[model samples]
Target: MYNNASVNKVFLMGYVAREPRIHNSKNGKPQLSFSLTTTESIKTQGGDIQHSEVHAIKINADAACLKDVNLKKGDMLYVQGRLQTHAFVDEQLIKRYKTEIVAIGVELFDPIQL
Candidate 1:
């Protein structure tokens, strides 16, 4: 990963693995955290089904749009932004690495218009 390039951006569209919640940073910045899950299913001609799943991504959204849209589990969301890595220490001082989407923007996913 290149640092200080300012070009490490990406967009994702998927379902939430869990509910979303809002919080404030110590410096008063707004943050919304949630998880994302991507899945794909296929049905064989013989009536058999197969599925694939992806681990959730922790996403943090800006506060400006937090109060505008309602984030719920299983809701289809369109997210646009950069990919970021967050680190933390767990219960017993175990180091954990998490990849999160630092959202630049988000919106409800509507397929009817597509």
Candidate 2:
């Protein structure tokens, strides 16, 4: 009988679309941002169709952690994180919202393994 309403967790396993961008937050904390691409094959009445989706990921960590990971383009990564929505005003003074995955843990596998 324990039901928690606040549940926001996400797990994604895919290829890195590009090199991760490293930047510092307003509080001087190191942050990383990247795009992950996931693909799936769907079978319809006609035939199988391949579909792909890209996700924006953000990670808040220290410089040492960033240096250790060294994520690169085309690398396979497994990310465990939570969904976060950010609202901000664009240059045109229009309100915009973006949802991204705030990674709590990330794992990198060598290309040779698979």
Residue by residue across 19-72, what tens digits does model 1's lDDT show?
A: 877777557765777777765567788885656444344344554545578889
Best by TM-score: 2
Clashing pairs in 2: none
lDDT for model 2, please.
0.88
Instruction: Give lDDT: candidate 2, residue 43.
Output: 100
lDDT per prediction? 0.70, 0.88
For model 2, the stretches where C-alpha displacement exceeds 4 angstroms are 63-67
Supply the TM-score for candidate 2: 0.86
Q: List the residue pairs that clash in candidate 1.
A: none
> Which 10 consecutive positions of candidate 2 have the poorest summed lDDT?
61-70
